[model samples]
Each structure stands twice: as C-alpha cells, then as structure tokens.
Target chain A: MNKTIFLLMIFLSISAFMLVGCEFGKYPLILDSSVTSGAIRVDLNLPLPVQVTQTTSVNISELRNVTGESVDSMKFYNLTLLIDNNTSPNDAGITGTISVNDNALVTLTNVNISEFQTERSIFDKDLAGKGFQYHAGGVLFLLNALKTQSPDILNVTVVAGTNASSLHFDLKVKLYGQIFANTN
Target chain B: MTRKRSILFTIMSVVCLLTVLTLQVRAQNPLEDAIKQLTSENAKGYLQPFVTAFGANMNSGLYHSADISQLGFTLRLDLIAMGTVIGDAEKKYKATNPYDGSEVETATIFGEQGAIVEPIPGVQYQFQNGQVKTSFIPFFLPQLTIGDVFGTQAIIRYVPIPEVNNVPKVTLFGIGARHCVSQYIPAVPVDLSASIFYQSLEVGNLFEAKTFSLGAQVSKSFAILTVYGGLQYESMSMDVNYTYTGNIPGITVPDANVSLNLDGKNQFRGTAGVDISLALLHIFADINIGSATVISGGVGFGF
Candidate 1:
C-alpha cells in the first residue's frame, strides 16, 4: 500500500510539472500590419452602410521554424487590434471586425474615432493640430477560432458610420502565446 | 578509513581552490567579463539560457530524506525541469561618441533627445535607445548525487557542449554534508538531519555563479514510505560581462564593455516531498518554493 501511494504521488507530481511548464513557456509575438505613410482612403458615398475590408497575410513559416511546430498546432492567447486613423474631421466612427481565412473571429463595435483622436493627441504633439485617431481593443475570442481552423491570412474589415467619407485609416493586430520548440 | 578520508579531502580542496580562483578572476569586473564576448544582436539571446539553467540547477535535491547509513550507500539521478518568468530587465545599452558631439538625425528614440526637426534633411527622427527585452521557455536539467561517504555526498550536474542549441556549455559541481541528530535519541520516531551544500555553475564564457545553501529536515518512516519537509537558506552571487561592437552610423561608439555583479542573498527556500523505497529501488518527488516554484522527481537504486 505504501509503495502504491508513493507511485501515485510521483505520477501526480510529474503531471503537474508538465502542465505548469507548458503554461509558462509561452512567449508573446507581435504580428503587426505593414504601415506606410500613404493613407488608405475609403469613400463612403456609394452605399448607406459602407464596409471596406483590407486583407493581410501573416507568414507563420518563420514562427514555425523558431518554435519547431506548425502554426496550426500552436496555442494563441491574447489578440489585440490596433487602429490608426490619419484623417481630418472628427465626425466619423468605425466598427472593426477581424476574420481569419474568411471566418469572423473578433468584432469590436462603436469605436468613437473623434474621441480616439482627442485621446491620442494628448501624448502625440504631431497629432494635436492634425485630426488623427488611434484606437486599440482586446479580442480574446479569437483564440477559439484560431484553434478550430488553420488560418494563414488575416482580413480586417472596417465598417464606416454614415458620416464617414474620404476617411483614411490603418489596422494592425498582435497575438501572445507559446509554441512547442525543439530544445534538443 | 584513512584512504577514504584522504580522497574526500582531496576532492574538497580542489573544489574550494577552483571556487576561490573563479571568484578572484571575476571579483573586479564580473558583468563586463560575462558579456564581453557578446558582439552581435543574436548573441544577446545567450543571456536567457544561463538564467534558465541556473534556476533549474538550484531547484535540485530538496528532499534529502534518506539516511545513507541505513541504505548502506545510495546514488540518485534527478531530472529537474523549470521555467522562470523574467521581469522587464534591461538587456541592452547604447551610447554615442563624445569626440565629435555632432548631433545627427536618427530615426530611433534616444534618451533626452525627445524629437527634433532637421531643416536640411527635411525630416524628423528621434534618437534610438537600444534596449531589448528577453525571455525564454522552460528547459530540463539532469543532476547526479552520490551519498554515504562518511556522512557526506558529492553532487555534479553537467551538460556538454550542445550542437545547434542556444546554450553552449554548462558545468556544475557541489558537495553536501548531512548529520543525523536523531541517532542520539532512542525515543524519537523521526529521523532528523541538518545539511549544508555549496555549488558553482559556469555557463560558457557568459557568466559564473556560486551558491551556498544550509538546510534542516525531518522525516518519519512508515514501512516503504517516507515524508519529509525542510527549510533552506541559500545565497548566490553571479558575475556577468558583455561587450557590444555594432555601431550606428554617424555616431562614434565608445569601447562597449560592461561588468555587473548580481547577488541573490539570504533566499529562504522551503521544500516538502515523499520518498517511496521498496528494497533497492526508490522513487522520489518534491516541490521547492523560493523565488520560483520548482517541481522535481527521480528514480534510483541503492544497496
């Protein structure tokens, strides 16, 4: 009986160590979108509810090489969206949704662009006189979609409010998680 | 008996001399010596491996529940795996040339120079402050311990030069002594022992660390099972040295040599574990709590 109990404890301890190590070994990786000085102008005069979707692909092959695991096999944790708007007139707002390989993963609603512009200008003196906005939001639900599907391309769709016309904006995304790497 | 005593003394003396020699060489410019060989951006990642290795090495042999005399002689091999959460520690430093003191337009942010507009260049750029944040995943460390040589034990943990790996080399050696105080008391049901250990770990040319720990433990035997708990106080000192060779254009880079001495002193560690020994076969597992939570287990044989 004593031997059996000891064996059981050893098994439990090994299991706990494996689980905890896996949890803590994860590192944060930032997948940022290509930013250019040129603005992405969207004309909202065509329809009442105008949606402009910009698609960007992230190559996880390098990440796979570093981690020694396929991108699909890795676990992703926090997903954040970065929205940069460099335009004039504070009457517009944007609703952003992120999709992986056509499947919608995260949707952020009612992001006030004018308020974002005012808040950002507090730190950035360059944007103080110029009407520019910066907004960020956390998208935790993206993890489930990423696990269920193998996504190679990320699609960012920005829906402009009715007052949005000739608005210029940029979008970026970041994820934090761990991958299985070959330590040998 | 005299031969055994002489062998032990010789081993102890050599280890002490090596420790003293290492301290003497690194006492003045420890951090500078550690990082002096690091020149490229990629070499900066080598620092994380040493930190991870040290943490794993320190987490070994927490139980010490076995009385070597009762077991005749014992040898144990422990596989310790651990991960440490590295806080925001500055991993890089950069400075400009003071010879010309010529203010040049740069795209990166530098200290004190917030933002400037260059009328001639027709662009605005900030000085770059070269700082990198480094963190690593969990790794495994294998350790060996042999006990029952006149109430003393010898410990050695070594990882040979790895191929295509982040860490190049790791060597650790230590000695421990345990005294059973319960031998004098006939009515005592538990075996009590006090132990002191000293170890030194050297990771390639990056850094060297020496640790000294003192602990006391008590365990009660119940047939094939033994449960033990102990409190330990450990003091560790490390020397780090690095040099940077990469230079920014138009900025005269000075001789980049850095030396640092880090001390983790008077760390109180607590450990609790169970040992299951059936005849010559024994399996042990323990959890050590200190700056980091470490879980370790092993299987070994004794006569």
Candidate 2:
C-alpha cells in the first residue's frame, strides 16, 4: 500500500507541474508586464500653421431665393481666404478667411489628429487629448460673416495652451444654406 | 386599549427587521442570476430559495412603497455570440477550428460560450437599430432577473451539484455591510478553497408569512475528498388577521386584525465534489445519468 501510494503521488505531482507551472483558471489574475499609452515628455512652441481649400461638394447656388433680394451666394463661393496661424507647429494648424469686401468671416474650429500630426514624429506617441475650446475666432466668425458669393469650411487645428502640443480633436459638420449677398 | 398595547410592542421589532432586510438586499453589485448556480457552497442547503424569494419580495415591495409610476415601460436589447478558445493546451480535447493560441478559457455569460454552460440552442434575436420603444409600467423588477438565476431557487437547498469529487463546496450570499466579505473571503490566499451560496425568499405579507435567509459557506480544497459545511439564517413573517374582541364602552363585536413576526432562522448545510476542468472549462456535472435532479452541475468563471 505504501509503495502504490508513493507511485500515485509521483505521477500526480509530475502532471500538475507539466508546463512551467502556470494556473489556467480560477487564480487571481496578475499582469506579466506593463504597457504605456502616450509620448514621453516633449514640447514645441512655434507659430501655428494655416491652409484653405475649396470644397466643391458644399454648393451655395441652392440659396438663390432666401435673401429676400436678387443676390447670389455662388459667386462669392471661392474667394481668396486670409487666415492667422497662431498655434505651435507641434499642435494644430489654425486658419480662417474674409469676404471680398473684407466683410466675410474666418472661423477656427478645434484642432484634431490632422492638426497635431502636422509633421511626422521621429518618436511615435499618441497626442490625442481632451480638445481645448478657447472659443477663439470661429464662433464669432460664423455669427457675423457678411454676405458673400463664396463660403468655405476652413479646417481648424490647435496645440495645447495658447500654443500647446499633444492637441488632437475633430469637428463634426453638416452644411446648411442661408441667404447671403456679396458685393465686390 | 388592549389591542393598542400589542401594536405598540411589535412596531419597533418590525421596523428593525425591515431595516436590516433592506440593507442586506442591495449591498452587492450582484451579476445576472444565471451565474449563481455554478457556485459551490459546502453545507448551505435547503433554504437558498427562501432567501432569494424574500430578497425579491422585499426589493419589489420597497419600490412599491416608494414613488413608482402606475404606468411604466421597458426597452430591452439582447446580444449573443458563439466564441471559441485560443491558447496553449495540455493534452488535447477537440482540435478547434483555428487552434493556435493559449487555451486559457471560461464559460460565456450566455449560451454563446463553452460546453455544460452551452446555449439552450436555436434561440435567436433580430438586428435592431436604435428604435423608439415606449410602454406602460416602465419596469417590472422581476424581468430584470432570470427567474432563478444560478439555480439559486427553491430546489438548491435539497439538491447536490455534481462533477467534482470529495472536495467540499462553499456557497455564500451577503447583504448590506457583509457582501464585501463574500468577495474578500474567497480572495484570501489559502491552500485549496471553494464556496457557493444562493438565496430566494419571500417575507412580510399581510397574510402569509414573510420569509428570508442569510447563508454562509466554507471549504478546503485538496487532492481528494474535499468536504465542507454551511449555516443559513432564515425566517418568514406574515401579518395574521385575527379577531379582536372589543370590550370598551361604545364598541361592539370583534374585528379582524393584522399581526407581524420578528426573529427567524432555519438552515445549515454542506457538500463535497471532485475538481474537473474540461477543454479549459471549469464545470461540475454529473458524470453518470448526465444531469442531476436540480442544478446538479456548476461552472466556475474568471472576471
């Protein structure tokens, strides 16, 4: 009986430790290693960048009758837009435009991935953060931009602080038409 | 005056009980009821159902006492997926479809995962968009449960879950301040340990007795013959309408009355079984006639 018991014990012990002794289930879980999420400490403070492009998809010709006057929005739909790049290159590219009569407005939306990765990184690290909203010039522009034959959506971007980095967030938009008369 | 005397005597007792009952019921962020059966409590037998029933009754009853809209509604969305395991293996079981990774696995919440804990079969649901759903009776607390989840039903008290050998079972349920202990105790490092618990109870009726239970379990796991024992505190209180003989001036005949009870506990139990893991599935099923009388099988899971 003693010899048989010994053999049984030996067999069971060998099986229990077959692999490098890792418990498959029922044991408290412990991570074997750790993982980090963002970039190491880094900073860049420079003049922000700006760009403007005509989105042919946003048609303004459909707003012919809403202005209460014989006016056209399609005519001013592609005016030369002027903008301010006040953000650091490491962050967003802030830009906006004015009307042909210098009465048009320039809007600046929050900067997103396109704004932050303005330049490729030598050391890759995620820069997305809870977006900053200083109101800046965009909101003011939308409410007051005068009549124009051309209207455009200037892609806005920003770095953190007045000129911060690791700034990434996007804007969601739907185009709506309203009456506007532009005089050169 | 005599009738008034009895009412004054039991009011505090009843209030105390109701208070304790309320605290215990909401203490745990308990999961879906279906997961309860897979637990293994050594001797917490024959009173699990009463505990749950009392819990259900009290939970709904308390809501009844509070502000509940006469008309309410529910919008339910359900999802299920059939998944497989991937990981390293010991000897082999069934060579699964794409069987390369580590085989660390556990039972799925619904029938979408694993064996013994497999789905009831053939049940499917429709793909629904975010649809506006409205109804009267905004909610039915009962439907919020799987009617006897985890086999924490009337039968668990008398039935013996199978599949394991000789290892004692430990079942548990804690209410109010004690629930943290349930999660804490099992997590305590021990050589070998297992515990299970269930409760379904009904209590505080104007007529029939209100029933409730407090159960506990403890066990030590070993290579062979793991055994255990348990204790349950249970009770039922009912308001009995008895005739009150009036003897005061200007009063005539007898009137029906309402009575309540305080103080209840009628339970203690235990059991043991062998440890078995199949295809990385931790289950305790009856090796013989397949299924047992009531909840004879159980499975363990990792969060």
Q: For candidate 1, what's the TM-score of chain A, rounded to 2 decimals?
A: 0.47
lDDT of 2 by residue, B118-195 (tens): 111211111101011111001011111111222121112211212123222212222211121233344653322122
Candidate 2 TM-score, true structure as reference: 0.18
Largest TM-score belongs to which candidate?
Answer: 1
What lDDT tens digits, residue by residue, belong to model 2 across residues A55-173? 21223334343332334322111111111232334444433322212223233345332433232111112222333222223333332332343343332221222333322232222
**Candidates' TM-scores?**
0.43, 0.18
| B1-303 per-residue lDDT for model 1 (tens digits) | 256644653454344333333332222232232233233322233343334335444645644483535334657655444444333332222322211234442211101221232221212222222121224223344556676665555555554432223333456666666766666665877877777777776666656778777887888778989888788877777766555422222222255665556555227768888888778656777777776455555654444
Q: What is the lDDT of candidate 1?
A: 0.45
- Evaluated with lDDT, which candidate comes out highest? 1
